[model samples]
Target: MSDTTNHQRIIALEAENAALKARIASLEARLQLNSAPPQSLTHTTPTATPELSAEEYLRYGRQLIMPQIGLPGQLRLKNTRVLIIGIGGLGCPAASYLSSAGVGTLGLLDHDLVELSNLHRQILHTLAYIGRPKVLSAIDRLRAANPNVTYIPHITALDKENALEIIQNYDLVLDCTDHPRVRYLVSDAAVIAGKTVVSASALKTEGQLVVVNKPTSSEEGGRGPCYRCYWPRPPPTESVVSCGEGGVLGPVVGVMGVLQALEAVKIISSGALEGQRAPASANEAAAGSPGTEGPSKPEPASMLFFSSYSPTPFKTLRMKGRRADCISCGTPSDPALKITASTIPDYDNFCGPGPDAVLLDPKDRRTVMEVGEMIGRENVVVVDTRDETQFGITSVGGSRNVPFVLWQRGGKVPEEFWRAVEEEGNSADPQEEGEKGKGTKGKEVVILCRRGNDSQEAAKMVMEDPRARDWKVTDVVGGIGEWARKVGGVVEY
Candidate 1:
């Protein structure tokens, strides 16, 4: 029972030991594969640095070879995700450069439709996409520019309901939106998600850029100040004019967008964008906050301002650090003011009174076509509510110009303008009135403007006039734009 049985047991033990060694080797190999950088989901096999393909290397080699953005920085850019909030003036250039620079993932968010009017500034879209949703058009253009990046298009408006969820997926956010409510929304969402925000705004000949919500140093205690820290709330609606209303120089917006792209690139690459040369001026100041008091010296963050009209267009000023009581990012000093996504204000209300605040009843609005049909009827008068300068440029023949700005400021169309309108209505032949029984002796006032928005308020103002209580007042939906598009006429803005 001794030597033979002992030899058999030793052989069995040796076989078990060999099998265990093989199993351990297999497990170790599997672990190494799992720990490597993620391969492309489109790939059928694992690869080293699969994020950067051969074609990509050829495309980005010039930038990859730079000292500041070498291989490591290029890889960081490839892994970064950026969300561009709007595809209009600022977003067009920002998205374009970010994609070309090899950002790994891009989220395009816009709800507007491309129009012929947008072509001059929104370079991401073209005449071919005159009626397409902006995000889709942007995706098509961006994909053509760079297929290496992943494009996520959100073709809806970002509101309180969806802002946080959508923004949390991106490492950084570019607030290219035009609306104040949207600016605040993006800022708050970025803060809550702990993401950096690069914001840019352009109006007429001037533009401003700022980076917000960057991580603060240990001494600062918490994150940097958000948009709200700079602007506690949006300015009044009448005071805040958009590029659409006031008109902007295309190059102004383009320059701002490019700067926004630069900020995003610098943030992702972890490189200083500051130049070695001295600043242009010692007295340069940052763009001032509209309503709040600002620091005497440059703050932790910086705001860059540009103007086409200025001799020295670019100016940078430091922004204040984390506000101890910021409702969005919270003060490092005060815990009670700490805010969450749920605690954020209804952005629409905080921005200003919304459309619902002065919402007109549906019955009070007439389609542009319906108003067009009523144009030749007896006792029906068309009031063009645009300013006098706008009315002089282009208008429907025989329509009276009420000049909405005057009316808004507690003035009315001069008594003579109203008298002439009544005379024109009365001049319609009785026989014609008989043929078109829709005609009436009572005044039927139809209001129209560049777009339908101002017309509603204009109609309401005319209705409440002591003399016009008996008159029938209605606003033309889509205003002159619909009239020009559907009924046929020149719509020169």
Candidate 2:
């Protein structure tokens, strides 16, 4: 097909997909209200049913009653070994539910501490338990939730030092860390270890989940597709933010985390929802095989992605197999997946923190507006550095109108404009020279102007000193115009 024709086709298909999602949302809401499974599969257990201990029995009572997850399925859950890497927001819910559901043995890895702010939706930590190691706290909380389960906690971040060793021991691996770098690294490690991986992500109010499991050819035994099949590389530096600094609706994560848990359970179980089809809802044939176990529960190497957005809705997309040119996973790296032992790759360097970090300044009044809402509680200050003409649109709600340039004629800055700005904040505190850069190096400053050029340079200039680099330095992503369309804050007219 011609390129234009293909492009048109893609657009049409995406629209169709969007429509289908809307319909799915409607159908799902109805399904919950009706308490229906659409189509329930019946699996008969053998005469000699395996005896589950008291804890296992109580924990899995609900799942076992379902014909699809009867005695055999419960056994499957008991025998399954699922490893959850990084127990942050996404990991917390996935791991919690997995443990509560009796996932037998759960292996967790994370090298961080819990802060009070994490309680907003992290769901794993409480204010009373703040300032404790995350891995340690997670294990304790998980164990208490379901004493029948076994908990294995690795108090270290996954890297070249332990990725292989850690991932190889589990039947499935769940990627819940918020770091894209770690996500990619874990994907490669799972592919190499010949294990099934279910990856999920939640940012702001949006979330994505993917299932990867490549099939072998007729001759050479093959592993499934890795995460690289879709996302090729991380976005440029300065294009990322954290939930700690970027406000997120706590329950938005609640929904995504629950979904992640469901996927993890489904990945390990050999029942209806795990890999099997969800049955025909409206005479629509299932996406995969008849009784086709979805990618969630695959033969060996498998992957699944599911994402949702609040103020919007929930959507699920499943992709199968590995890409040939996946920079991290493919024919060129099969031997890497065949590691005789578990290992962690050098994640920091692989993820990039090199000197050439691209610093983007998406500064604009609109940018300030979008970010103001993001850090609403912090009372972050926005500095307007636009010229007069552009200042007409600047929103002063979250900003202080400190135009860095006062032009006299022909776009030329007035005399001592820089000196005035340098000495302007002094009125607040003349004795404290260091305090002059209140929002610049210490408190919090988001430089904004028209088109993001002047503000970008201004922010960079303020942070030129090594001491100021420790201060939060960020350029609004996508410039002000883009921010205006996404999140509406306030614009000074």
C-alpha RMSD by candidate, in order: 16.9, 18.0
Kindly list the per-residue Cα lDDT of model 2 for residues 1-493, writing each as its tens digit: 9987885575455445534543464455445425532222233333223235555666677787887666656655755667888777877888888888877678878777777657777787776556556665776687677766666666677877678878876777888877777777777777676666777766666666665543333112345566776766665433444454334667766667787778666645553233322323342222222233433323433333323433436544444455665655555455564323343445566565522243553332235455757453342555666545445654545455556544313244333333443344344346556543443334455666544545555666656645445455455543444455555554422
TM value for model 2: 0.58
Q: After superposition, how far is residue 372 of candidate 1 from its true place, in Å?
A: 3.1
Each prediction's TM-score against the native? 0.72, 0.58
lDDT of 1 by residue, 1-493 (tens): 7986875575455445534543464455345435554333334222445546778778998987887676556766765768999999999999999999998778888878888889899998988777667877787788788976777777679998899999887778999988788888889888887777899999989999988876545225445678988987678765566677667889999999999998888777752211111222222112111112111123367789998899998898877666667777765455665667776567777767653344478899999778877877767888887777778878886788877666556555445445545556547644433322223347788888887877887777667766666678888888787888887655656
Q: Model 1 segments beyond 4 Å from truth?
A: 1-57, 127-130, 238-246, 271-299, 331-338, 352-358, 373-381, 407-445, 465-472, 490-493
